[model samples]
Target: MAIPQLKDKQVLITGAASGIGRAAALAFARQGAHIIASDLRLEPLQSLQQEVQALGVNCLLQAVDVSDEAAMAAFAAWVHEQVGAPDVLFNNAGIAYLGKFLDSGLEQWQRVLNVNLMGVVHGCYHFIPLMLAAGGPRQVVNVSSTASYAPSPSMASYAASKFAVAGFCDVLRMELAGTRIGVTDVCPGVINTAITASGAAPSMQGEQLQRLQAYYRKEGCLPEVVANDVVQAVITGKTLVLTGPYSRLLYHLKRLSRRLLFKITLGTAAKVGYL
Candidate 1:
């Protein structure tokens, strides 16, 4: 069923050039929402704008890097000026880093956290005021990862950033409890996207990276599955959504037995040479 609230609504999404963000932009556009899409790349955003406009909805495209606070602030101002406050703000821009803590340097950790954690922060810091001013029913969706709860030794930076995002969402939700704005924490498991290939994994060889990418392509779920969950979450005011294959199972297992979850994850990581 189409959501009545989404029709003709203003929805702002970062990282909309590809992967989950791209899927989400299309999903929202299909519901007749006006899309405000951004990414660090321009070409893909243009292509996405064409697709979104073809869906018979308006799309405003921009090349904005979420990690850059000043740029994000300008973008937020532009959004407010262009279409007033957005009914939904999807802070979905993120990157991945895969390596043991000792193997990765400070630069790698900083880069990961800057994009994955601070990007979400920048979005909320700049856009929340606009939503507050508009003051009806609004949604803030933050894209976290299953790694937030189900930690892995090989993905130290990625896990840390996601854990921070999850924590931030929890606090933000509590703070906004009395308001009409709803916060959603979206945790996705493996999904077939270019992130696996584009992520930084310094220790892995070329052949190993290729194998890992192939594994994700074969075993991961589609990005649209997560996008559908995002739409449902907004409609129902869901606080937490675990999407994609093994996402729910992993969350449950982590809650059931952290030690067991670690044992299983560590064993699997070893098998895949991620250790």
Candidate 2:
């Protein structure tokens, strides 16, 4: 069911060129929401804009790196000038790092955290004030990962970044308690997306990367599945959304017993040859 309130609303989404962001853009467009899409790549953003415009909703495209605080601030200023405060802000830009803690370098960790954790911070810092000043109902969606709850062996940096994102959203939610604004932390399990292909895994060889991508393609859910959940989260003001296969189960398992969940995660990763 479409949310009637979403019609003519403005939505800003980062990492909108592909994967979950692209799917979410189309999903929101289907709901009659205009899109403000940003990505580091202009060509894909243009392609996404074309498809979004075909959905009969306007799409404004920008090439901005979410990891850059100054760039995000400038983009936020531009957005305010163009459409005031957006009704929805989706901080969905992130990168993946797949390597054991000892194998990964400090630079790799920094890069991952810059994009995954600090990116969310920049988005909330620059945009939330706009939403508050506008003084109406609004939603902020931060894309964390199931890794936040169920950590895997070779994804130390990725898990750390997502954990931070989840924690940040929790506190942000509390701080915005009395306002009309709502914060939702979206935790997605493996989904068939380019993230695996684009991720930095220094210890993995080309063949291993190919195998990982194949595994995701064969076992992961579609990005549209998560996209639908994101829209629903916004409509219902859900505080947390766990989507994709095993995401909710793992979340519950972690809550039930952290030690058992850790064991299960290690066994699963080994069985899949990810460790």
Candidate 3:
């Protein structure tokens, strides 16, 4: 398929308050696309709206909790009323959990699964039907993580959620193959974002936490880089996109030897004080 032109297209992005979502909203807006940016926080969404509109393109900001089925449904309705349907839907809202699965509890699992996994499910369930009805050609981008392939020992729930996202996108992509809508599973490695800081549990305050944060800061790629890649992938109708070099490497490593990869990942997590 030929690359789709984004000019004047409607793009919907969740978790647009920060990180890759924020970067994507700006990137698409710069390409002359109308942006519907949604996030959990109103203040940040408002700030994002200003930045997006500054690009001289239309931007609609909504405070949405993507984990809520009812809220997502309402958001879909609102989008239908305001912009009809998005030419591109980016289901990017997610949370991170950074601790051993044993140290975590049921609440952590529920929260992580709800936001990181079910959030994508809700977005697709509510938005795809609308997109199909409004579409000639459109796209859906589901944000997974490098953890989808190479999960750190300390981040069990997070890894599980991302794995589910990747699997779900795989199925969705096959189902939508004959249609004009394309599904992309985006697996991003560490990107400089507040997710780590926000996910830091109360019990995790100390030198170990600082070290982990430093590692991400020193090695993580910029969110804008991922955003640019996502835009290009959408134009080319890519089915899977690994954002950072590390993410791509991890994917290949796991494929080569799952057992050896697991040991290596566990060892590295322990050395980094993540386990």
Candidate 4:
């Protein structure tokens, strides 16, 4: 797929207040994308707007919780009214939950699913149609994680949520192929985002956290790095993307050695004193 030129492209990003979202917002702005940056955190979104404006790209801020379909719908409507539908939508707001499957309460599980999976779903429901109607240079980028395929036993909920996002992106891409819209699913490995600090609960335990711990060092790729990868993916018509070598390795192993993966997961868990 040829890389799409981004000069003056209209882009909207959820979770743009910080971490990968904020980083990508800045990168896109520098490359000349008019940005609509949103987050639940008002101050950080304001900060993001300032930085993006400094890059000489138009930037707007909104305080939005992506899980709220009504809020997302209204947001889409506002963007249409104010600046027109976005050429690119980054459905990037997400959460991390690592806990035993049986132990996970409905509330906790639902919350994780809401943000990580339904957030993407809601964004598409409201935004994609408008992008189709508005037309041209339109794309959607969904940030998934390696855990979607390399499902960690303890982080079952988070893994499930991401899997849904990946699944949706894959199907949605095909569905929109004849239209003016494109979709990219990003499976980033351990990005140095506050997601570990803010999204994952301290109580997460078991074999899953062990595997994640093995992969996530304090020195993972910076949020900025994943952000750059995202922009590249959006520009290209890349359907599936892994942000790092580890993510690619994990995704392949899961495809090639699913049963062995089961045994190795338990064995590795036992070695780590997690099983």
**How would you encode candidate 4's per-residue C-alpha lDDT over 94-181 as one tens digit per residue?**
8776556676666778898889999999999999889888866688899888877876565777888988888998899889888878
Pick the lDDT winner: 2
Candidate 1: the clashing residue pairs are: none
Q: Write down the TM-score for model 2.
A: 0.96
TM-score of candidate 1 to 2 decimals = 0.96
C-alpha-based local distance difference test score of model 2 = 0.89
Instruction: Quantify all predictions' global Cα lDDT against the true fold.
Output: 0.88, 0.89, 0.88, 0.80
TM-score of every candidate relative to the true structure? 0.96, 0.96, 0.96, 0.89
The reply for model 3, stretches above 4 Å from the true place, is: 1-3, 201-203
lDDT of 1 by residue, 1-275 (tens): 11247999999999999999999999999988999999998888998999999999999988999999999999999999999998999999998777667866778888889999999999999999899889868999999999888866668889999999999999999998888888999999989988865565577757666666776888899999999999988888888999997799999998899898989998877765566
Candidate number with the higher TM-score (3 or 4): 3
Which 10 consecutive positions of candidate 3 have the poorest summed lDDT? 197-206
Query: Please, what are the lDDT tens digits per residue for candidate 3 over residues 37-107?
Result: 99987888887888888998999988899999999999999999998988899999998888766666768
